[model samples]
Target: MAKINWKPGNMLYPLPAVLVSCGNNKDNYNIITIAWTGTICTNPPMTYISVRPNRYSYNIIKETKEFVINLTCENLVKAVDYCGVKSGKDINKFSEMNLTIEKATKIDAPLIAESPVNIECIVKDIVKLGSHDMFIAEVVAVNADDQYIDKNNKFHLDKSNPICYSHGTYFSLGKKLGTFGYSVAKKPKKKYRKK
Candidate 1:
């Protein structure tokens, strides 16, 4: 089949749509929905989120050098889209979205109580890249809701039904294939019982 030529653009789709919570103390807390976020390093657990300077939460995170990457679930899709399109300056997102702010362990920024996982972060560096600035942060702490944990203590993040952003649309993650190292992993050997 022949394909039509399309203009060169950012066609990289299906990125985690997370609500990054920022600011210190109760009075200054804010949230900014971000799709331009990804794990940068595995050794020290580092991640980056790119935000435009005009975003209200951008300045707060820049000035404070800290934020929480709250993983969005299926239920959080509405708030995630709302937080991205609406400015924190014009509205109290927590109140408007009916989201609860819970106390974080290591940072002053509040965690989204509704989120199954919250990754507390401290900004290590900022790179200015035209329309957006990338915040490189060290993951300080990760909090997960106990409900998603199984009796075996296996955290079933997949059951949370995480949401992702792609080409201006939000989508829920679907299905699971093999896990890490499965391709090269050795198969279990079977033991023959004495007949």
Candidate 2:
């Protein structure tokens, strides 16, 4: 395979597309779709979402210091795309996108009730990095919808039909979130690579 260096840019493929809801109250509540987000630490449950300084929700999150990361699925893809492009200042995202806001258990920010899982975060620090400022937050609470509680989905959490973004397009990874030891389990006697 021949590989050529194009340009210095964000070449990381397949990132979780999340709807981050922010604001202190119902009047100021807003949602912004973000792909530049993920878990950074495990001990205290930390995560970060990078947002453009000019975004509508940027100041809301900055002042409130709280937000909810709503994991997106196939059904929410249209809304995700719309939310990312449309400014919350011009329109009510929750009403326009038809998303219900639920009160977070441990945080002041409201969560998307339709989402499979909502991670409530409290902003620990803010690092201004070029065009986007990274909101480094600590996960205070996580709410998983009761619909996901099933013995049948013990191994695969694919029922939600999760969606991810690569470059400019959103893609769905079908089934099997992880199956690490499948090969080893099948051929135990064969010596394999570094574990």
Candidate 3:
């Protein structure tokens, strides 16, 4: 195998493309597509999203200290990409994209009604990094679409056909392979009964 080296940069590919909604009310509500976001902790439940300081929604999120991460599905790719490119300062994103705003439980930030999952987070801290600033937040509430939840309440997000960003393109999740601990766990034993 051969490998080529390039300049130091963000080469981490295949990241979840999510719509991050912010602002205190309908007046300033905005959505920004973020690929630089993920879970950072489990105990306290933390996640982060990186955005440039000049972005229209940056100050809204900074001042409010809260936002909602709307997980994007295949159907939301157009809106997701549009939100990424368009500036909230010029147009109303929710209206332009036809995305509905639903009230969140823990945060005042509105949730995307059509999103598969809405994760409400409170900004715990902010880290200043070159190009973008990282907003470290504690997940306060999570809302999953009722359609993705089963009768037993198990969330089947895979069925939603979630989309991810790779390089410069969007891709859908593929078929099932194995779940957590499936390789290490032993199969259940069958019991024999006398006829």
Poorest lDDT segment (10 consecutive residues) of candidate 1: 7-16
Residues 82-106, model 3: lDDT tens digits: 9999999999999999999899998
**Candidate 1 error regions (>4 Å):** 3-5, 187-195
lDDT of 2 by residue, 31-107 (tens): 99999999999999999999999999999999999999999899999999999999999999999989998999998
Ordered by TM-score, highest first, the candidates read 3, 1, 2
TM-score of 1: 0.92
Scored by CA lDDT, what does every candidate get?
A: 0.93, 0.91, 0.95
Which residue pairs show collisions in model 1?
A: none
lDDT at 24, model 2: 82
What TM-score goes with each of the models? Answer: 0.92, 0.90, 0.94
Clashes of each: 0, 0, 0
Q: Residue 62's C-alpha lDDT in candidate 1? A: 94
Better of 1 and 2 by lDDT: 1
